[model samples]
Target: MSVTETTVSSPLPPGKYYFSGNEALAEGAIAAGCNYYAGYPITPSSEIMERLAARFAGLEGRVFIQMEDELASICSVIGAVWAGAKGMTATSGPGFSLMQEAIGYAALTETPLVLADIQRAGPGTGQATKVASGDLMQAKWGSHGDYQPIALCPWSVQEMYELTITAFNLAETYRVPVFLLGEEAVGHLQERLDIPAANRVARRHYQPGAPPFGHPDPAGVPSMPAFGQGEKLLVTGSTHDEYGFRRTDDPAAHARLVARLNDKILQHRDRIVSTRSYRLEDAEIAIVAYGFTARSAWLAVDELRRAGKKAGLLRLRTIWPFAAAEIAALGSSVRQIFVPVPPADRRPDHLPGNHHPGGTGAVAWPATWKNTCARAPTAPRSVPAAATAS
Candidate 1:
């Protein structure tokens, strides 16, 4: 597949313009009602901070700070958001590891914020410039706990532009931290992004002069009062009740608070999860993939179908609430499911034992079917030639 050029027929509005993935992220933050950004420079992710710094330089009612480290960076952003400003921070894998504790804090406190992890190869600083989807497991379980986070993976430049906006909206609407799970390729790739006008940008609004945590609507999402709104607010990481105060020693309070945080995202998974399907109606075999791997799978599927095989592609855009229902529906008719694992240092040894040799490479599939419904161990699987016909 070829990279398409992004075109612009007209100039942008006063404060809006076309941008690349990096610039699109910055613009999305601005559109999402973000007024403050704090982050440290890291490869494959620094562009987000750079663009925000330049754009927020002269804007009133906005601030951008370059902190000493990723820990302080995330801490400051959380503080700013609670103080009544929409806040965000960006970093790569190693830095993301550093921010795990703080991210858990944000999740527990119900702080609405956006986090962008432009992923790179790593268990620990493995490769700064190389691209890999190694962070899939990390993004879901990075911050040690049972919390559901709204995570969106963008495969192209345009999605990086659009999904970042959606991430922030999800954060505010659900009162949870939303993640923009970007890969190095998408982050660095330059493409034309048609940014929507200011009025077209969707932003969550607080009830006029509403008190902090004051229920505004049935969605359980309150209109957040900005800091200095003269509203007395309590924010803490410990298990808290509806009012956001700490309930340190109470087991029941902890249970209810924890359940609420998890349910807030899981109950609304239908609204938060999205996937792109191709030729699924008649497919007899399906390939499940996400992010950059989805692109390769799409190509493979098209080649297979042209050779008179029934194959389809399921591309997951929302990675975290794992689109299980959609995958189950797609898998119902298919005989086999091919999950392409990108080239990595640690090969998954649990695949089912079915293998076929291609001209120069061998296509393998797992032997036993592991339903995504349960947290089953990864099993060895096989990919039939019909599934990779080309």
Candidate 2:
């Protein structure tokens, strides 16, 4: 057992204890400085809220609210953030579907928050306890409009913990809603997780009189000022000026405001996108995957290698700002690129549907089976990974 020091000079527990992915997510949120968690209980994702409910009982100023419904759940999280607290919420398919409106509000208001979707099979009341990777597309497009979303897909229990912390850091850094897309298998899988020391301290970047929105720091992200901060701020979903005044009727203002929102994420993409290139060097075929489906892809790729076939995997750590350049490069280098999607996602021309907010939808995920998000088989730019990212 060894302890790793973090940026905040806090101490990580120096031992190993078996923990489920959902439990690790709770611990990670706490470590990342999340003090407010409001959520409705949903299968798979319920463990996350449940774990936090018990943990927060002993921590001062930390709150765990079992909201009456997903609507109330998202509202509580948004309210908590406005009051200068780090906020987080966890849910599955149905709850995720219910959260779209608030998700849009978070994006339009540029609220720094984290949402975790421990995906299960869906559309309606799919499997409750069964593992599924169904929410991959919904996490991106479920919210409306043109906004860049930062979504992290974790394949294992370790990644579930690490990525949850990363999601918080990114949410604050970008002043955007960040999503942690965890499949059911990873959410409930028990494994030894070594708790890492706390590193990040959540905070607002506002000065007493600075504008609350519309000013993109050189980093391309606006420094956010929460309510109750000394700054006089007006936060709303309507198109607004940098000073937070609405310009909903002005086409130019509307265009510029929306464009800035998109540009803040797209223009400085490298800062927000992350991917794992596995054995890509000199490989002939590439397996592109994310979330739970990535686990099977890796195994299949590994098995093919033992049989002496050149193979590799491109694991998507960040799905929203999908790794277009990397995927494009693979298109040129590899003889074949395989994306292992679930049977429901197997329909031909399914990639476009996933990319279109109105097209088909993010459906079921594979548990001990193959699940995946589709990339273009030939044209990298033509294929869409997480289409509704904002």
Error of 1 at 177 (Å): 0.8
lDDT (CA) for every model shown?
A: 0.71, 0.75
- Cα RMSD of all models vs. native, in order, equals 8.7, 6.1
lDDT of candidate 1 at residue 150, scale 0 to 100: 77
Q: TM-score for all predictions?
A: 0.82, 0.86
User: lDDT score, residue 196, model 1?
Assistant: 57
The per-candidate count of clashes, in order, stands at 19, 4
TM-score of 1: 0.82
Model 2, CA-based lDDT: 0.75
